[model samples]
Structures are given as C-alpha cells and as structure tokens.
Target: MQTQKSFEATTQGILYLVPTPIGNLEDMTFRAIRLLKEADRIAAEDTRNTQKLLNHFEIQTSQISFHEHNSKERTPFLVEKLLSGETIAQVSDAGMPSISDPGVDLVKAAIEAGITVVPLPGANAALPALIASGISPQPFYFHGFLPRKKKDLNAELETLNKRQETIIFYESPHRLKALLDQIEKVMGPERKIVLARELTKRYEEFIRGTISEVSEWAQNEQIRGEFCVILEGNANPVSENETAEWQNWTIKEHVEQVMDTEEMSSKQAIKEVSQRRSQPKRDIYAAYHEI
Candidate 1:
C-alpha cells in the first residue's frame, strides 16, 4: 500500500504521465503545456511524432524514445533518471499515455522504485466518444481493441454481449466492417451501435444506428479514419437462473439446440455454447463432433 502525494516535495524526481491531444491541437491543455516545458526530459512513444507536437507548442524539452518495442531497455534507464532527481514527462503519440499506448511498463517501474507518478487529466478518446454515443454513460466497459482472429473475436464478443454496461472499443478503419459484421452476428442486428471517427477533428463524424443499419452503411460507404465504437448494453442480460435452463444440457445438445432455435450455423452455435458453458472452444468442438 503506497500513498502518493503528487505535489509533495521530494528528493527523488516525479514521473508525469501527460496526455496529448488526440486530434485537435487546441485540445492540448495549459497545464500539459507547462509540464512539458518544465520537465527535465520527455519520454515519448514516437519521438518523430512527438517532435511535431513539441514544435507546435514551441516546447524545447529534449525527448528519449520509450515505446512498446524498446520499453524493456528504456524503463530501467528512465527509472534511474527519476531516482537521480531528474523530472520526466511521458507522452504517447496522442491522447493519454498507457491507454492502448506504451507507458504502463515505465509507470510500474516508477511506482516500484518509490518514485511518484503524477497523471495529468486531459484529452482521451473513450470518454468523448461515450458521452456523444447517446448510450447510458454511468456504467461503461472500455475494451480498447478486440481479438483479431474470427474465432477469438467471436468468443470475446459473446462474453461482452452479457454486459449490462455500455461497451466501448477501438478499431482501425480497415477492420471496421468486419468487426461490425461480427457484432451483428454475435449480438444480433437490432443492437444499437455508434461509430465515432476523427474525433475532435474538423472531419469528425458519427454513424449511429442498429448494427444491421451500420453494416449496410459500411457496405456502400468507403470506410476511413480510426473508430471508437460504442455499443448499447444487453438490456436483458442472462442471469444464473437464466443459464439454469441449459446448464445441465450436454455440450453437444446445447450446440444443437442453439443452432436449431436461433437458426445459427454450427460454427456460430459452437461459439455461443462455449461462451455459455465457460468452456474451451476446442473442447466444445470435440464434444459436439464426438472427436
């Protein structure tokens, strides 16, 4: 149990987790600017990209590369600098560091070494997309990126489909259509979803509709920009008692029933059965196939 008084004076240097503007330069806060100007050094995910931000703000602080590929090599070095009382500010390419970025390893090292980690609140992509989604905001689950593989993505979506809170996800433009297709397959076409793109930028856009509608829209429109997908929560989540109806059934029987009742293909039925039983997909497959 470690208590951190972020502003308290200490002999050791503090590590500031600064957030950069996601898209708009105006989103950069005064405090973030000041901290960047005052810090002894800035540890950036991409020095070239961060150099642009530094140039825009006229911040002359020197930067050291500390990204995902080189984190293992740089974390110890950064920790040493902090121990030597050299203040450091860590920034990602955009938005908050460590949220789908490369700052967690260094933050963990700083904390373990008894160094203070100060996080400055500023721009982030998730919240802005959530509030504008017209979905309930109180309870939200932010799952940054989903699995890439079809089976893995399907299984993951099946679990998320049980959540009572709004779900948020980040997806690249190239994969958005495929993702929406999977969402429609797993969560049903009627489920509401919003796709927010180029957030805070002049070309920012929001495509809101049922999963089926969005899927149809994607078919005709040329997809562009990163997306923050906000999905409405399961209005009628399955409870333990709800699972009781099929809990006692054999895996094969469960898959057969789901395929027959929902009119889903065997593969989709197997994925759903695995999720419901909390069993491995391969195991369910073997049982269903009598392999």
Candidate 2:
C-alpha cells in the first residue's frame, strides 16, 4: 500500500524517469532539459550517446552509465545515491527509459527504498507510429519486441492473433522480412498491416497493405531503420470449428450462443448470426423472437 504524492516534500531525493527524443532533437522538452540540468546526476544507458544530447542542449551535468549490461551492478549504487538525498535522472539512448530499455530495474529498487519516482513524458515511438498506422487507435496492445527464436515466435503469434485489439510490435531492419513472412504463414496473407520506419527522422516512411504486399515489398527494397509493425485485429474471430457446431443448432439457439460468447447485444448477435449462417437478418430476428 504505497501512495506517491509527486509534488510533496520528502527527506529522500527523487528519481526522475526522463524521456529523450527518438530521432528529432527538437522534440526535447523544456522541462526535460531543466531536469537534466538540475538533477544531481544523470544515469544514461550509454554515456557517449547521451553526451551528444547533453552537448547539443549545452547541459554540462555529469552522467553515469546505466544500461542492460550494467543495470544489475548500478541499481544499488543509484538507490544509495537517492537514499543520500541525491537526485537521480535516468534516461535511455532514445525514447522513454523503460519501454524496451533497462530503466525498470532501477525504478523498482528506488520504489522499494521509499524514494519518489517521477516520470516526465516527452517523446516515444510506439504512440507516434500507432496513431499514424491507419488502424484502430483505441484498444491497442503495445508489444515492444517479439521472440527471436522460430518456435517461440510462432507460439507468440498464435496467441497474439486471437486478440481483438490492434497489435503493435517493434522489429529491427535486418529481421523485418523474415518476421513478415512468418506472420503471413500464421495469420494469412490477407491480413492488413502497416510498417513504419525511421520514425521522426527525415526518411520516415510507412508501408501499408496486406501482409503479402508488404512482404513482397520488403523482399526487393533496401530495408533500413527500426520498424514499428501495426497489425489489424481479427475481424471474424469465431473459428471454423465454432461455425461447424452452429449447423447443428437452431437459429435461435445460435443467436443465444453468439450473444453469450461474444458479449454482444441481441441485435448485434442477430446481425452476426445472420452473416455467419448466410441468412437474412429478418429471418434470424423472427426466429429469435419466435415471431
């Protein structure tokens, strides 16, 4: 039972989760610059990469290396600094710290030590790519990266295909083609998908089409930049096996089953049942009401 009053005064120093621009340097927020300047120390994923950002903004604050390779060794040291009333600002090479980055471990340690952790929202890649993907913006599942192994990847895709919400995934340029091919195999070639790359940069591009079209495009074109893949949700999620069982049931019984299983209204269930059974809506409605 922990409550965080962000603005309240506390004896312990605060931990700030800062977000850096993904590509465009101008996307850096004024508050982020100020925090970097004011924080006692900056914990960066890569000090060299982050140094360029600091130099561009003319921020001379010192930075300590804090990335996946060293997070285990650094988390305790950062927590100790926070315990000693030294403000710590954590930043990744780009975008938000913990999203596909290693800032989460430090955050957990800070929280356990009773230090206030404040997150500053500035820039991120997932939301930007999602809104522009021409897919349903609401009810989206942000999957940062998929499993690399073939068996694990197939298993993951099988589960992800069942979701009704639009799915988002991050992929490197080198593996993009193989991933699309695998998706085509599991989800079929007709599924609509969008691929956005070089986000926020000058060469930012989006390829929107069916999985087959996109996969074909990837085969010949020079692939570059990290990709944000937006896959359309399953529109007709009811499996063929479910439809097979519908043949044995009465129209009214089918409507009731769809209503209960899909959690849809009677009107919606009737419409769905009519489409699945290849019958008129009026017929389904009449059968449902015993009219």
The candidate that achieves the highest lDDT relative to the unseen native structure: 1
lDDT for position 239 in model 2: 72
Question: In candidate 2, what are the lDDT values of residues 180-270, reduced to their tens digit?
Answer: 9888777766667999999999999999998789999999998999999999886676576976888899999999998999899999988
Candidate 1 residue pairs in backbone clash: none
Clashes of each: 0, 0
lDDT of prediction 1: 0.91
Work out the TM-score per prediction: 0.84, 0.83
**What local lDDT score does residue 105 receive in model 2, on the 0 to 100 scale?**
94
For residue 228, model 1's alpha carbon misses the true position, in angstroms, by 0.3
Candidate 1's residue-wise lDDT over 162-247, tens digit each? 99799999999999999998887777666679999999999999999977899899989999999999998886566779689887
C-alpha lDDT of all candidate models, in order = 0.91, 0.90
